[model samples]
Structure formats: C-alpha cells, structure tokens
Target: MDWITHDEDVWFDFRGSSPEQLTPGRFYKGTVDGFADFGVFVDLAPGVTGLLHRSELDRRLESLDWESGDTVFVQVKNVRSNGNIDLGWSIRQSESEFRGAHVHDPDGDEDGERIEADDGGPEPVRKTPKGISTESRATNGTESGDELSADATAEQKRVEAEHDETRESEAETVEPAETVSAEPDVVEATTSDESAGVEQSAESHEAEGTPERAAAEDADEGTEAEETAERTEGPAAEPERVTVESLGDRTGDRVRIEGEVVGARQTGGPTIFEVRDETAVVDCAAFVEAGVRAYPEIGEGDVVRLDGEVELRRGELQIETEELTELVDEAADAVEQRLVDALSAKARPETVEPLADHDAVAAVTEQITDAAEAIRAAVLQSRPIVVRHAATADGYVAGAAIERAVLPLIRDEHSRADAEYHFFTRRPLDDPVYGMDAATNDVTRMLQDNERHDEKLPLVVLVGVGGTTDSLDGLGLLGVYDASRVVVDADAVDTEVVEEASVLVSPSLTDTGAADLSTGALGANLAAAVNADVTDDLSHLPAVSYWEDTPEAYRDIAGGVGYDERRTRELREAIALEAYYQSYQDKRELITDLLFEDGGGLAGHVSQQFRKKLDDEVATAKANVEARTVDDVDVAVLDADSYSHRFDFPPTSLLADTLSRRDDSAVTVVYATDELFVRTDADIDVRAVAGAASEAVPEGGVTAVGVRQNRIEFLSGARETVVDAVVDAVVAQI
Candidate 1:
C-alpha cells in the first residue's frame, strides 16, 4: 500500500477500496499523476483518479506550473457512469487555503485515523492492563488489511473508547460509559508506568502536583465520559433535524441542523462556519477558548450534523453551536444528496426559448445559460449581487428588469425583511465602460465589508455596459479578490472582454448583430431565465426601451399584457426622468413602483413632467440650431453653451436625442464650451472624429470623452475650427 503524508499529523493510504467515499462537488488534494493533450490525470486516491480538462483551466493549459508527482488541488465536477471522474481547476493550490481537508477513506480501521504502514523497524511501545509493554509484533507485521494481534486489538478498543468519551463530553447529554467500571483501569496503569520511567513516582506527587498526577486527572475525565456514552447508547433519542430556513422560528430554542460546510472564517472571538442546507444558508459560530479552531477536521463541502441554539447576534441570525458532529454513512449521504439536488435545480433554468425569439438572443444561447447559472449560483451561495448599467432609458429598463426578477426570489428565500437590500444592489453608470471610478468605489466597499463584517465579496454584474475592453481594468480589479463577474449586453464587444468575465452574453460572439436588439429585451430574457415567475411582468420592458423603430414582436408582447403605446411611453418617460434625477442610484423601489405597480397614477404624473421638461428643452434647442446642408446631409448644430438650458430640466443627451428624431437634422451636434454631443441616423465613431479634428486643427484640444454617448470635448476658444474640422471629418467618414 502506498501512502501520502500531509504534514506530521495526517497520512492517507492511496490503496483504494470503496468508490462511494469520492463524491462530486467536493474538493480534493491530488498528485499530478500524468498529463495528455486534452487534460491532466490526478490521482485523488490510488483507484480514484480524475481528469482535469484543459478547457477548465483559468490560464492556458501549457502555462500550468505543475509537473507529474506534484501535489495540486482540484474539484470533482462530475462522476461519470463508467466510473471515471471529471475535475475542475481550483485556484487554491494548498491545504491551508481550504477550511477542512481530509483523506476520506471509509476502510480505515480506527475511524480513518491518520496512520502509516509499518516498515522494517523496532516495534513501538504498546499499553497493557498492568504496564507499558515494549512489545514487537514483527512476526505478524506482514499480515495485511489492518490485522491486529490480541494486544493490538485491546489497544484499538481503548482508542475507540477514548473517542466515544470525547463525543459524550461534547454532546453533554449522554450517560456515562459503564465500561469504565467493567474494564480494569488499564489507561491509568499505562500512564503511571510512562511517568515512572521519568522517575516522577507517585510519592513525588504527594507534596506538589507532578506530571503523573496531571496525566491521571486527564485520564479520569476521559474515564468518566467513556462510562457515560457506554451506559446511554440505546435509550437516547435522536435530536429533531431542522433546516436553516426553520431557524428563524427556532430562535432561543435548541435544534439539530444537517448541512454542508460551504465556508469557514475565523474572527477574533469565534470561528464562523457558513452552513447551507437545501432550504437556505446561515452562519453558525463556534467559540472554543477564543481564537482557536473549533472543529479543525471539518472542511468546506463536508456534510455534518450540528446541534446549536439559534440566536440573534448583531441584528443577524446566527447559530451558537453546542455539539458539531462530522457525519458518515446514512446521515452524511442524505445531506449530500439533498444539497446536490437543490443546487442542480437552482443552477439551470428550464427554458431559454422565450428569450431566443430574436436571432441575436438565440445566437448567444450558451452565454445566456452560463449567465443564468452564475446568477443562480450567486443567489444560492448567498453572495451579494451588484448590477451596474448605463444611465440611459434602455439601460435603466434593462437593469430594472433584472431587479424585478431577482428581488422576489430573494424575498422568498430569506426570512429577514431586509434581505433584498443586503443581497441585491443596482447602480447606474454614466459611461458604458466600467472604468476606474466605478472600480475604486466597488473595491473600497467590498474590502471594508470583508474586513469589518466577514462578508463575502459580491458578484458584480454588468448589464448594457461592461461589454467593452475599456472596462477590463475594473473587471480585473474585482478578479484580484476572486469576485465573480457576468456581462449581458446587446452591443458588439471585444473578445478580451468576453474572456475576462466569468460569464458573458453577447450576440457578436456568434456572428450576429445586436444593433436592433434592445438591452431591455436581452435583460428581460435573462431575467426570465433567472426567475421565470417574472417573465410576464418583464415582457413589456423590451418595447418600452425603443422610442423609435420599436420591434413588432415586442410591441405585440406589450400589447398582449395591456400595455398600449401610451402606457409604454409613459413608463419609459417616467423611468428616464427618474434615471436623470438619480443618475447614480439604481432607484429600485421608485422604478419598481413605476413599472410593476398598479394604476397608482405615479408613472402618469412623472411622464407628464418628463414630456413638459423635454418638450420645452427640445423646442428651445430646435430654434437655436444652425441648420445647414453639409454635402447633402441635414446637420443641426446647437451652441449648447448659450441657447440650451445646461443646468435645467431635460439633459443635453435627451435634448439631442429628441431633436435628432424630429426633421431638424439628419445629424444633431450639441456643442457646449468644452463638450459636444452627436446623434445621427447612421453609426459614427465620435472618437474617430475627435482624433481627426485634433490632427487637422491641433490647437483645438479636441478629444472623445464618452464612447457610449458619442460625445467629444474641445477647447472653447477653438470652437469654430474644432466644429468645422469635426464636421469635415464626419462627412469624410460617412
């Protein structure tokens, strides 16, 4: 039999027996047995080997700094019917990284104690009824499969009795073991002999406490506990098993919970263990002499039984653990199965066909599936989800759609009234790129939460925004701390952005154009996949995104739900106004009231304001435009710095959009002192125009500022020259 050693206290025999001990979704430490073109083979145990596929590697497979015979960490992703195992690459590569790591071998004789095979050497000292026996079992050492002589069997029984005693003391309810009286005081005599070898005799302990006296006292406590369990084994009733969800009702009451240990972190006082049952997840805090590891053997992914009193700690529900037992056999098997089944049900949605009605949506079916799974996993893991979207009508509608879908599920899953607020947050971005400003804010908040509250980092989701390479640095900052990311966009983006995100939903990857598809429509479909119950409510959102060129299919969907053109426009207007007022906020409740609530007349009132404000600004802007034909193109140029109301109601972006829609111009350019906004029927790279203008009129100090809005900033003194140069550049490009 071959064995592997983990430090001085742990040894695992790789000579495999039962395959049942190896379960999927569990992390394992294995040696890199071999490698192939497709993947690497890892020997979890001797017979229990798994393949780490190349596709699962975080980096290129060739870049892996691992060699055969080196120890590595891998996750069991799947166990095939043919008895083969599929492994996923783990970011953590060491034992200390995981909460609990153990060699799960059911065949071990003494409850899987870390033991090594005997080599040719002197037999170790053995304990007996009368004294310490320096016995050599060399004659019978060659026997296999944990074979024990008469003396070895007695020692094994003594060790088992000690364990039973430890368990009884921990549980604190079982009766004393009767074996303490039935069996002679062999443990005491053995300790006495060992101490006598040091010349610390019984007489030496009469005046003062000797080492033998202290040892005797410790043995007495074990003797008392062993006697308790032995006497109470049959009559004690099993504690009632409870789920984490039921813990709310069981506050101030003692209950037993069975769950998988998903996370474990140590605080100054208590070791907090995040345990998740099928119903929900909760933290269980165990304090053992402050700053000590409460249960060192229990690691993440281990199924165990915990007895504790539910209590409110710092306004949060936490379990005060009394007795935690790492389970085996039927109890462990049952818990593991329940967790796996629940995760499977939550991770995959039933259908994505409703979202795939459009060609663009259909093309990114795989991406949609991945995004849905990542969102569901985040919910299941109880990680907070942060959704960032552009501060446009389309982006607002899209962000709200996801909010509508996820909020209900959070409310249903968690017992706390404030769970929705804590678990989900949406932020509006003025720019499409998740740039430095946004990343700095997120990192600051996340790091503070992690340090002050022991909270897990959030899953940052980008809708309508983070699909461009410009957002790479922000995403990279989040990744530095192992935060997950998902991007859902109806815009063409670079491949690097797709690869940087954990999950990306974009049609461009499938060679489909997303120009016609509204971000609201894409988000609605994703929201449906995330929580199908909200599908009907979100059906009208796609139609609301488009002020012009509204898709017939989406309009029909809105119409079917009794949201006529008038109601749709009203909702859209209301959201746009709210978005302007709270450009940085998600405005979750306010938007929810406008979109999903009944005839409260809220949207109508807001929409009226939206119309009045916009109509006034558009009216003023149209009158001030210097309309002209620049090579047969109807160009409307407004000196936004003078005529346009810069600090008032309708923003320049909205004003520009409204003016462009009217017959004022084929292209609209609103110019402020240092900034310019461009809106046109055809797509134009405002950045390119700025570059050309800067090169053509060097002193203009022109540069593209907002990529998403197609805006540029230039020197006010060189305004005319910069404007002429930009107009010429645009004419040449078009």
Candidate 2:
C-alpha cells in the first residue's frame, strides 16, 4: 500500500506547559477553555491559551459544537510579542486523522524529534518549539568549553526538584479521580493522564485551596458525558422555546427561539438579524468580526432556530446569538405557517370607517380599506414603502398624515433602531402626475437595492397624484416590474387609472361629490385604517389641508385636538413655504416637528417667512398685470417670466391661484417662457383648453401637464402664439 503526507496531516504535542513552548504554523491539540463575545479560548497546555476568533472559523461562532475542556484541533497562526496566541480553525478534529505526530520537549533539544509514520510513510519534517533551556542543551564537547555559573546550576537543580515533587504528588492522586467529586470545589478529571496533569498544575497555583479550577474541570467533564450520552441515547431534551414578545421577561437568560428572518443588516460591530415570530419582532446580533457578515448562508425570509441570551441594549431588547440554525422541511413550514396566520390577523383593520361624515369619503370607504390593508401588509413583510405626493401644502399634509401613522408601526414591527428610515420614505413630486421621470428613478433605486442588499421592491403609494391619464404610462412602468402601487387622490381621476392602480381611492371614480373632499382628508382616514393607534394625532390634518371653506366636522376635530383655526392656518402656511423651498425632499423630521410637535412655536416662526416671501412676490406681479376682456369676461394675464421672480418663492401655479383670489369672478393666467398656469372660480377643464390651444396652434406643441393644478406646457419658439391660443381657449370654456 502507498502512503501520502500533507502539512495538515501532522499534529504537534507540546510536553512543556508554557507559552514559549508553542510554535506557529503547526497544528496542535487544544482544550476548549471558554467562550467570549468575539471568539473561543483554547488551551494548548496548562496556563498557555490561544484565541480562535470567530472570523477564523468555518461557521458562525455560535454554531461551534466544542464545549469547555473538550479537545479541539487548531492551527497556531501567530504568537504576539505580548504572549498572546492567535489560532485558526482545522478541518481534522481527531488524532487518528493525522499521518504523523511529533513530541516537542522545551528543555531537551533544539529541534524536537518527529515520531515515524505508523504505516511506513515518508519521514515527516522536524521543527523545534521555542524556549529550549541553554543549561539542558549544553555539551562537554563544545570548542569554547563554556560552563554554567554556580548560581545558574543551583537554580536549575531547584527547579528540577520541584517538578519531581509535583509529579509524584500528581501520581498519588491519579487513582482517586472519582473521589474528587465529593469536594464541590474540585472537578474530576476524565482520564488518569489528564487527572495527573490537572492536579500537578492546580497544586502549583498560589490559590490552591480555591475550587475555581476544579469547578472548571468538572464542567468540561460533564459536557463530555452529556455529548456521549446524546450520541448513544438519541438526543438530549431541547431548551424551552420562547416568543419574541416574551423576550423582555427573559433578559439575560439563554433562550431558544424560532422565527422568520425579516431582515438582515451588517453594522460596524455585528451583523443584525431582524427575526419575526408569531407575536413580535426582535433583533438578534451575531458577531464574527468588525464589519463582517456573521452567517453568509442565513438571510431574509429564512426560517431559523436561534439560541441566544436576551439583553436590553440602549432601552431596546436585543438577543446576543449563541447558535443559529436554518430550518427546513416540516419545521420551516410550521414556523412559516404560524407567522402567516398572525400576520393576516394583524395586518388588516377589521373596519375602516370614514374619519368624517362626507358623501365623497363614504363613497370611497372600501377602496380606502384596501389601500390601508396593503400598506399595513407591506410593513409586516418588511417591504420598503415609497410615498410620492405633490409638493404643495395639501399634498404635504396628505403625505405627512400617512408618515405619522406608519413610522410608529415600523418601529414596533422591526428590531433595528433605524428601521423607520430604512423601510418608509416620502418623496415630494414637482408635478402632480406620476410621470416617467419619477417612475424611472424609483425603479432604478429599487432594482439596485434588490440586487445589492436583497431587499424587496418597495410599495409605491401615490398620494394626491397618479390618478389621471397623464400618470398611466408611469404607473404602467411600475406594473412591468410587478411593484405595488396605491393611488389616493381627491381630484378627478381618469377611468383608465382604475385598471392601472393596485388600489385606487378617489371620489371622482366613485361618482360622488368631491367638492368638499381634500387629499389630506382621504390620506388621514387611510392612515387611521393603517394604524388606529395614531388616529388622535391625525384628526387635524384634513382641516390643515384646506385653505378655505374648511368643513365644520374637520374644524371641530382639529379644535378637539387643540389645533384651533389660527394654529391650523399657521401650520398650513409654514408647511406650504417649506414645501416650496425643497420641493423634492421629504424633510421628514422638520415636517413631523411642525405638524405633531413643538406646540405651534416652529410653525409660527416659519409662517412669518411664508407671509414675507408671498407678499413680496405678489407685490412684484401686481404692478405688471396686463388686463384683457375676452367675450365680456375679465381676464388678467401676467408675463410671469418677465414680471415675477421665476426661480424664487410662489411657483407659477401657486401665484396664479393666489392672484385669482383677488377677483373671484375673473380668470388669472400666468404665462412663463414655455408653460402657463390658469386659476379661476369658474368651472373650466384645463385639459380641454390645452387641447383647443393645440389645435389652434398646431406647431406650438401645447399640452396640459396637470389638470388638477391647471398647468400647460408648450414649445418655446411658439410661446407668443401658444399664449394667445391658451387665453382664447380659457375664455371659450368659461
């Protein structure tokens, strides 16, 4: 038979019990000492230990099967100057796996002798361990004839005598290993050789009378016995499993939990796994190395069994994981079923009633319920939610109401402290239509996140937008990727959007009176349906959405919530101003503070800036207003590009709305270089006017951008012609 030799097929046995006797790059037998947060400590010899970091392990640190005092195989990677040993994992776990072995004597020879292969294989390499005593290696045939001093020889003799005495005492105690159990302080050794070695080491310690060493030894022996029993007698009884919701009571107690992993994130110190059970969600922390993922095989959506100790970290419950095992077959199915049943019961509200009694709100109650359930389900599944709303006071209030309701649910449903920011987002749209520009950006981001982080595509909630024909293309783009879209708009919606949207809540689609309806009112009710716990906080949002003719019921609700008429007005104006400045940003914290906190102090300060900016813009436009009479109707036209601050506060549409309020009977048309805004009290279809203008001036490329806001865009070269045609079209409709 032929034999082969490999580096890993060799093992080292160090006879001396000292740190200096260990050699790097050699495989050695070690006893498991204990565990730590980062790694396990292994003892090569008595008082000589090495650290096998979790990063060096082939599996998660918590998944290691070795127990204290059990023999483990490890490779010495390095020996630091400070006497610290860094160890690496070895595949071979038993002495029988090695083809050759070496016995290292620290006091005998410079190069330790290697034992020959058991079955006549190639000779193994010879390597010396460190710390060879010069006094023991000194020879009489030396050329220099150097001799040891009297003091050195005397010290060596004394050390040898002590060693002999300690060995003799250990031999005497070897037979009575089982008798040591009577003393609670000392542990019984597993074998005679181990018993002698432990006794000799323990007697050398100054604190020999203490039971600490014995206790440690006993734990190792007990673990070995238990493992042996498990192999021969089926398996040991499992620990009691606990639910995530019950973790608070089990703080500092090691527990076994079964759950679905909703999310996983790698932080600076540990990899955090957000586990969701039937009752609730909790964060389980598994550390391998700084910034390194703990278990690459485990990921979101996996059903797993986790063993960990519960701890309260920074006022939040966290589990420090000891072992994480993925479940499959029947076990996984059972856990997944439990989570599904709980999620279905908790995600949808039992009833979704309108916040206030209005015919339009009542008509869309079912649709609102569906939208709310979808949003709630998204949260429970750990899916990201992206809310797109118009950049106006009413739009901000609509989006903010939903934000206020969903944030708390996110915090409650996820263990990560930053889950609210990660799972929920509100983006302001410059235009009310969910156009291709916005859709492309959203799809790009979602795809990147899905590819890089393994995240689910977000639930795109279109508030006060995505309910018209103009948004059909954009909504269709999202549908191509199977992204969920919920449209909640108070404005008239095209019948086509009903098919494109996953859930549509619009008064016009239900054929009800929407004159009294505001997007904020619809959004607030939907928010309440999503989370009824925050219903009190959202009662005032509808009142804030309106600039005029605030409903009596909404006003009462606002007043009941301590937001009187004056305070509501101040908040609306403040949000309107802030909304215009950073039209694209959510400004989540600032808006939350103004709407739900600070008791009107920040709103008051911000409202002042709103008034000053609006007054200045209106003043500048009033001086250059051009008046015209089309078919006996008073029409006020302003060259917004030349007369108004084009890039500043008071956007063209907002300026037109404000200027139209000056004469409710007259029509206000604000025309920029390539676009126009129309504001009037008369019933006029802006899209109709744009269509008529496009026909009147075919080369101008006139088109209606937003019918709700009454905005039109045209080619700049035909700006003069397009403006005249738009004015004529508006007059004909009036």
Candidate 3:
C-alpha cells in the first residue's frame, strides 16, 4: 500500500552534524538521551542535544514511551546565541513519513533529491543530491557567484563527469517509476535523475548569465511548492483504537480511546477531561485556544470517542486530544455496560472481617462492612473522599488509618500519578463535632470545585465526630447538597445521629461496653475492612489510642507488630502533641511515620515534649485545687481559666482527666470562664447533670457539648451559678 507523505518538506538526518548546523522549522532525527520532569532530552549528534519542553509536547512528560537510545523526530524550534537549543515535538516520527530525507550541513542546505510519484500524486520539490558538493555549485556560478581556483575547478569537473557516467549507467537499468514503487531506499535512488535534471537547468541559467531570469524562476518554484503542499494536506490516517490501561505503552503515538467523561477541568492552556473506561481513568487534554474550553458540547458523564496522542507530562499520562466525538444510542450503551460490569467487580471488597475479637467491634460488623464498601465504591466511581475527624490523638490515628488504606487503592485504580492526593482528603476538626462551621467550609469548597471544574460531589466522612446532637445541623447541611455521609465513632451517639448519617458505625448502638472502645480502635478495624490488604499495617493502631487501659488483644497485637509498651506510649504521646499544634491539618506523612514507621526514633523526641507539657500543666493545676464535700462525696474544684494555659498544650479536658487520675476525690470539676469539664469515678450521667445545670440557671444558656467527655458550656456571666448547679447535680446522681 502507498502511504501518504509530506509533499514539500524533507526530514534532516543529523547523525554527522553539530548544533549550529540545525535549521529552525526543519525536522531532525534524534535519539532520546534522557527524561526530566519538564521534558525529554534528545541528542541530535554527539554532544549536540536539545530540550523538548513539556509545554511543547502534546501530552504530559511522564506519559512518553521513549527510552534512552530510542530514535525520535523533533523540529529545531530555536537555537539561542548562548548555545541553548529549544526543540518542538514533531507529528511525524519516522523518515518514511517525509517525501525525502537529507543530511544536514552547516554551510548551506545539502538537500536530498526528491522522487516524483508515478501514482499521479503531487511531485516533491527537486534539490541537489548529497554527492554534489557546494564547491561544484560555486564553479557553476549558482552559489556565492565566485570563481574557483584552477585546480579546484578541474577537481569539480572530474567528480561531476564521474557522477554523470554513474547516473546514466544506472538510469538505463532502473526505471524511475519502478524505483518509486519499491522500498524507501529504492525511492531515494529514483531521485538521481531529478538531481541531474536540476543540475542541467542550473548550468543553462549560468550560460545565459541572466541573474533576473534565475530569481524569477526560483519564485515560480516557491509558488508551485506552496500549491503542492496545499493539495497534499488533508485528513490524517485513523489512529489505532486502544484502552486507557494501554496508554502507557503507546505514548507519543496517535490513538483513539472510548470512555465516559467523569470530570472536566479548564486550565490556563487546555481543558482536561478525566475519562474513565473499564480498566482505569486517564486525563485527556483538549485545547481550542489558550484559556478556552475545547469540545464545549461534550461534558461530564458523556460517552465519548476521542482521538489523540498519548503524552507524559510531569510524570503523569495525558492525552493531547485531536478530535473528541460524543457517542450516542447503541454505541454509548455498549461502553456504559462495559464500565458498569467492571465497576461491580472492582468496587466491593470480597469480604469484611473485624480485625479483633471484641464485643464492641462485633456489635457493628455489618455497619463497618457497609461503610467500607461505600468508601471503595466512591474510589471506583472517581468521587472524592473528605474525611473529617476530631483533632486528637485517637482522631488523627483514625483518619490516618483510613488514609493509609485508601491511598494505595487510589494509586492502583487511577492512571494519574497524583490521584491519591486529588481523590482523598483528611481534614481535622477542632472538636469532636461536625458542626455548622466545619460543614459550611466543606460546602463552600465542594461547591466551588463543582462549579469551576465540574467535579463530582465528594463523600463526606466523619470519624470520631458527627455522632452527637451537636453535629445534626452540620450533617443536615451536607445532606441538603445530596452529598453522601458516613459517621464512625466509638462513643454512644444520640439516636437522632443514626438517622442523619448515611452509614453509622458505633458499637454503642448494640453493646453497653462501647465506652471502652476508642475511635482509633474502630478506625483501624474499619480501615482494615475498607482495604484488607493493609490489615497487617493496622495491627498496632488500636493500642496507640488507649492511654490508660488498653485491651489485652490490642496490646498483644501491638507487641506482635514490634510496638512494645514504651514504643506504643511514645507513638501515642507524639501523635497527641502533633495533633494539638496543627489541629486542622491532616499531617498525614508525619503521623504515618510516627504510627507505622520510624521505629520509635521520631516518636521518642516528640513524646518527650508531650510529657513535659502535660506534667507542667498538671503541677500548676494541683497547687490551686479547692477541696470540698458535697452530699458525702469528695470533690476537687479548680478554676481552670486561672490555673491553666487557655490556648496552649494540654487542653482543659486533658488537664482535668490528669488531675482526676491523681486525686482521691470522687468527682473533679475543672471550670473555665464559659465551659466546665467534669471527671468522676461515679456512674453519674453527664448529660443529665448538664440538663439540671441548665434548669437551675435557666438564664445561663447552659448546654452539654460533649457528653462522652462530660463537657458543658454555659453563659460566662452565670459561671459561678452554673458550676454550683453542675457539682450539685453530679453529687445527687452519684
């Protein structure tokens, strides 16, 4: 079969040339020397290389399939005076794609003779062959218009005479039409006749000695070349159809891919469409113009067949789209069904088993299964996951456990290198409540992403939070946007919380022993349930959450995993300290290292800070404690606002717990200006006490913010009255 080739241009072979020999706007054959984040380095000759910048590539830099020593074609875009070379990507990669090929020369264009196609296609422009030197052309007055030395003229004539005899002898045996019909090398041979014809015409012009006549003839030839190029230019050949998973092997080659457009983002230079097929998701970048959207008629959720060149940019695979056509009816149905089948097979875990044998974990096994499946499905569907956990040691461990499990899935499922960061996010909540402030911020960011980038609404997950009455308004706000919500906590949640969340995993619903469960224990088990591949990594996490009375099973698991009592305590203390300083940031890497890696090297240093800070705060509080008795119960009261650092480490709740552990009192009451924390050995209901306090001081606006922590907030003006009411209520209940 006859392949269509470029009519007027010739690809330059730079095997023997230097950098200064390269001509701008001309394509050259080069070897791939290496790769960089910005672009590929191509060597045209020994020590002669140029940078094919990412900006010049049709696709991402990382997507390129070119390896070292592999041949590639690039156009010399510019050669700086400072000896820096800037290369541009060439659409045609092979020498066969060009009508003719030439060996580059520094002095002038040493063109290769062009062969005329006998199939009635446009004839390529004729030029001198490599065998004829520039000195020969100077003797004929065609170059430099200077006369050569007697010896040099005689040498040129003898070489021309020998070349003519060889050309004539070859012409009699090999017909030009037959040569052109054969292989590429035979086609090059056919150019000899044309090369001779051009030489004869040059000599005829020299005999006339009419410079005006030669200039007019050159202009006529230039016009004819333009017409030939216009006639030859048409639609490119159809590219091979391939899958998204196969793009890694087909980089720098044009191909067609069919998939559903899951997301679309408009950048400063191109519109990137994240297309998902049965195998995986790949980003296709289409450019109409700078900052303008491409294929505006096609959007997210549309089934499309796009033709583009696969490219690697910044270590990510991306398609530089040529034509994107939306598939319809039967065509769309076929692709959709294929994707649906794949999603069904890959989105759900085969089975979910609890990490440990505990009644609290067993009580919520089904809920954990559902939550894990939901998370997995979200990843397969390309929906972002937003995990909001309480900003505490247990909360960070809980969030980090899920992060560790989900990130590998994201990397495996998505073709983009940065999918892990883009698909999953862990944000820490200031308190163990997904309140309106947090919900409002989440809504604002998600809405902006959806509006600006056409991104899918994210799955909002609440860990160690959102299992209380205080989070109802926040959960409700997310529900209004139709965002999926999952709540996981160890604390006993309000009954209303169960109805508000999409999925609730709390042992408190079915087991009275839920109070012994820490959010970290639930989180680690849930993470294992989400991705069982990471079960071994989560073995020690449950032990890290419990400060005083860790369960024997979890403690054994920690020891088995090489985390002894000291190491476990160090990790716990380190995470708690780090969690306080940047309560809102996930600090995923630092926390991961402390919890799962570093072998106690990092944890040792940070835990020291934690112990020092807490010990100092506890020492200060012990000096100011006021000992009293209420209803035959020993009580110790400390004005936390006066005794503790309000905005510093060892928060009021932690301080109160520490003091209660050290005191002989039956109840410890740490009262701040507007809030109070109650710690007791008695089985008194904290929420009931908060209710009684609110009733006794009806005008104080007293409320229970965290029943699990026995935390209450009241009007600052009624602090004195609210404290007495709370203490009396606690004593009465005991």
| lDDT (tens digit, per residue) of candidate 2 on 338-359 | 8888777877789986777878
Quote the lDDT for 659 in model 2.
83
Candidate 3 vs. true structure, TM-score: 0.65
Better of 1 and 3 by lDDT: 3
Better of 1 and 2 by TM-score: 2
- Candidate whose lDDT is highest: 2
Tens-digit lDDT track of model 1 for 479-498: 88888999898877778886
Clashes of each: 8, 2, 7
Model 3 regions lying over 4 Å from their true place: 1-259, 265-272, 282-293, 304-341, 414-418, 511-513
Q: Which stretches of candidate 2 lie above 4 Å from their native place? A: 1-232, 235-259, 264-277, 281-298, 302-338
Tens-place lDDT digits, model 3, residues 503-615 = 88988888455978999999999999888999999998999999889998899988998988998899989998998887888888888788877867799999999999999
Model 2: residue 640 alpha-carbon error in angstroms: 0.4
2 or 3, greater by lDDT: 2
Arranged by TM-score with the best first, the candidates are 2, 3, 1
